[model samples]
Target chain A: MTEKIARFFAENRPATPCLVVDLDVVARNYDRLSGALPDAKIYYAVKANPAPEILRLLTGLGSSFDTASVPEIEDCLAAGATPDRISYGNTIKKAADIRRAYELGVRLFAFDSEAELEKIAANAPGSRVFCRILTSGEGADWPLSRKFGCDPEMARDLLLRAAALDVVPYGVSFHVGSQQRDLAQWDAALSTTAAIFRDLEEKGVALRMVNMGGGFPTRYRTDVPGTDEYGFAIDEALRRHFGNRIPETIVEPGRGMVGDAGIIQSEVVLISRKSANDLRRWVYLDIGKFGGLAETMDEAIQYPIETERDGGPAEPVILAGPTCDSADVLYERAEYRLPVDLRIGDRVAIRATGAYTTSYSAVNFNGFAPLQAYYI
Target chain B: MTEKIARFFAENRPATPCLVVDLDVVARNYDRLSGALPDAKIYYAVKANPAPEILRLLTGLGSSFDTASVPEIEDCLAAGATPDRISYGNTIKKAADIRRAYELGVRLFAFDSEAELEKIAANAPGSRVFCRILTSGEGADWPLSRKFGCDPEMARDLLLRAAALDVVPYGVSFHVGSQQRDLAQWDAALSTTAAIFRDLEEKGVALRMVNMGGGFPTRYRTDVPGTDEYGFAIDEALRRHFGNRIPETIVEPGRGMVGDAGIIQSEVVLISRKSANDLRRWVYLDIGKFGGLAETMDEAIQYPIETERDGGPAEPVILAGPTCDSADVLYERAEYRLPVDLRIGDRVAIRATGAYTTSYSAVNFNGFAPLQAYYI
Candidate 1:
């Protein structure tokens, strides 16, 4: 889609290097994801964009929270999300963090290893546990094949071990990986999960909540689905997997929830020649791969950077970050056409960067100013 | 080189997740580069590791400072590098930042575009400018080439423009990109710079410095040179470019100075399996891309991640991050056989991360805590 990014830029608060959150886009995203997984529960991943305003928007959209650490849990709590409505998805927790989360009444916790099971048993004594069965896919952005998923054989055995330790295994939770472009991977992985569930049922293991976790797609381009956005396949999978029997599917989409909602409204800092005598020069904006690609050096979930004039056709130019690092690329090479005569301080917005753009990326390694936040 | 990285874990400071800056290595780096370019000044690029301790060490080792922005300028100034010794490398600057630097008496500055020249002329008319000629090479781990650099042909014109604007073109500066591995590219680019300097000198553009800006190599490996133990091509290039030249030949080595000086020492938190039957399980660590590979994600700078326990022969394992984001990877299929039975809270130190780890990475992303800083 030919997005009017400049207009979105112009409509932001008076912070040059600020992150702009589009409430309307976020609401639409919530509705779309909630509708697609009608039987499932949607927990907005707070880590993506944990600005107080964004959290409030997620709360208003009738979504729960998927918090990882204590700060996330605290942020959700401060944002008025109840303890029961939040699940600590990052199952590996510090001893202090675990006790604090347990104290805060966070029930649903994800676990991948036997050591973690024992820690959970010792910490809370009887906290509700969700064994995180990490999934694998061929085209997965972050292949979950190694992260936190227990092998199906080991997972079953671990479940028995946890049961013996008085650690209640709520259900199985597996992420097909973030930004999953291929939908069939989800189908096959879910089929594998389903088999595990059936085996657990036969063995009389408490198999209750099958968290066909969140990796649902959000369209970055009109032509294809992003790494996270599975397009129609995920919706169809939801329909096929639980045709008659409904399961409590918990999805924590860090990028999908606020990815489209946020945009980095920045100025054209330096417009200079990329090479000697190249036809066009680059439009260096205040935000670079370090800022807009805050959570990512590679995976930037944004609509292409396109600028507009008052009454002229849009021109796309290669937009980049302020860092001197060459790898600090924002929009890929010549992907976006921008106004050729773009001057310094000319405002442009990098759309769909609301998620994982600000909080996730604030180290200021180059000692540049940290990104200020604003909500629209 | 078989680097004993376990020493970093036992460095006796900070929490499980911490950055250990080995002062000894940093001093040697500063000494080697300074000794090689004895006649020309060496500006320690503050963007590499802006931590106060790192800055103190570099400044203590008799190196000038190269700053990109105001905070960096302030950092250099605070480190007592003096404004005259600090060169504002960022060509794009607002009137305020320029005025601040000029007021602080920053001696040298760079401008890539004519617009920036005009602005510099209007704001800091008395300041001398460096005509940054764009060099062609693509292997910068942190590529600054994409943003900075003017066409050599147009740069010739810009040199004349500087003459007209009364901004002294004290020297010509061109970077061969960061993490530049190709020595031949430097040879060609410096030869091109020398040619441009000669042409400019023929055109009555007198110069005092030919800033062969730093992209010197430094890694955990010994065969590549410029690692912890040996100096790389810094002296060879100086000999070729400025042999017996009366003018100062400048080199601003950020990564080269500290890339091997610091190591990201983190403790393993948990290890989990992907599927029930999968033999592989993930070992999650306290430090992640946010703290280490925060800036360079897609083309992440590969470092040697080693465990501290010196037991039997080393074995390689996939170390994952604590963040829930799948793309948050610490290593790409890294293998270092230190110990087979690595457990939770086992310390792992990632060498060659000193340059960008603390400087570019942010804390509070994904609600994870930031790495505590410690220096020897």
Candidate 2:
């Protein structure tokens, strides 16, 4: 919708349906989160749109990464992020994957099982580990406690075993779910985690870190509170737990840090009437679901479409992707004004697709070429 | 979730995820439909999942394809399918895309615009065409009639204009919609289209082809009927319209023809609890939203997930993907039994992820590799 974005078309390089991120917005987000929680460490959730540019930008802002896969680990390394700055937060990893992370000099690893601890002890005895605690007041979107986390009692067992084995169990971590709406849920998860830490300390394992997993929602749907509030609450809770001597903390915000900071723009390919009520509008966007927007089924993200660069006003239109599925629609109730005389070949912008918008949900259904990403 | 599918993982060979069509069931489906509609044309929508093997199989079974993209054109061509056998059914036009389809000898082009016709006329002189009529069926999950079909008046004008262009314009095509549930609504669309055909013939345009565009639903939910009744009924209605003298009738059955023929076998890696009630289990076996089963989101396709190698039934567990999104769940309120003490390493099988599955939705997120395609 901006002149600079429109100018991308005049370049005549690629076709419709691609993603572009404004680095300025990303830097602003990093600064906001880091500024709010000065004592806590920030680690970008690389799984959320891990473009090389994005990784480089976050690292440049002095943030580390939370990577789950070997490829993601490789991405952080290639982006010049030191291995110590990266947290291999995923449990149930392959031995080879763990070995790869160790080879990369990643000192902080998140773990759950006795088997995993044995694997790490055999592979890298120098690793400083985190024993994950299942501490939701029972409301985290990820009943992570049930599937992945060690029960508080079980966690004490694991940490005590690690201490005896001479493996430095430095931290305790738990995620309060992604897109969290209730601030009290986060506050409760932290409070419960602190109890687990104190209990572990009493059992002769002194904790050096508290890894508060990322679930800070972004400023998208008003149903959930904004990112700034998440930062402030997290800061306040960290003080309660560590009491001015806050151990190093890692906050991995995926969608919250970048969801609103980016937009996906596309071009209208055809506008026709399907029947009396359904006005079928197809945009030959550079960004297809596989390349850009892939969440087209069950739940669709918002596409606040803007027709004109200069708002003559707004129009409501149900925009669908070029994919064949009827569910390929990006918006059903979405209304943005098109120039009443909107024609074919006109371009439009679908806002708020930056986080988990493209790479997170994208799947190449038609074998279309992957979308090209650019930083403005 | 039978052991028949779990064998796929025992011998792990990496390949892209693709639609695996059962030649036996495919032939049966064709015979079944052909038995019902003795005189109708079967045009497969290649955009569903255009693996070359599937394409060749359908063509061998005597079914044509409904293509929407240039790569699809190339796919049909690679299968040795004649240009006459393939119809470019996309109603939108990017001049280059249209020209590619036209240059590839695509005679039957679906147009929703006078401007599109003009472009085809200028670029593809004397190209055979069809003016798609927009439908108003509320039965379709996505009513394509809204986006790429000409209204009755515009349809008439386009027919007249085609007559003036000194080119060949065939009969009309209207896609009732994708995932259509109601038969009466399609009957209305068909009868309306039939009336328009009569009007076009009276105007002396000499209509010949009647393309009832794809929207036949294949049953995913057990509560709905999954028979070929809708396909049979649509054909029967068309029979009543022109009696024994109908034009070359065409209908594209995308999901219905291929959705349930294959299975995606995944393995349960981590089983965790989300809340006290919901289990947050991440089965990092292999299948993902990109591999095709991700479509039925609100209502996930209840695929029978089984253990590898005929292992004895284990306890019932909830399944999910390795992707960190709280929403990345595969089954909804369904139970899956694993090998009693299912651990970090185990395999699970998911049935009926063939149509609109795989071959499209792949993103290099985390380190999860793309799917591997194995055809028998």
Runs in model 1 deviating more than 4 A are: A1-13, A22-36, A57-62, A134-153, A179-186, A223-243, A310-316, B1-13, B22-25, B56-62, B136-146, B179-186, B224-246, B273-281, B295-300
Model 2 C-alpha lDDT per residue in residues A77-107, reported as the tens digit of each score: 9998999889888765666677888888887
Who wins the TM-score comparison? 1
- TM-score between candidate 2 and the true structure: 0.83
lDDT of 1 by residue, A129-158 (tens): 877665664655434435556667667777
DockQ for each numbered candidate? 0.51, 0.30
Tell me model 2's lDDT, rounded to 2 decimals. Answer: 0.67
- Candidate 2 versus truth, CA RMSD in Å, comes to 4.7
Q: What share of the true interface contacts does candidate 2 keep?
A: 0.31
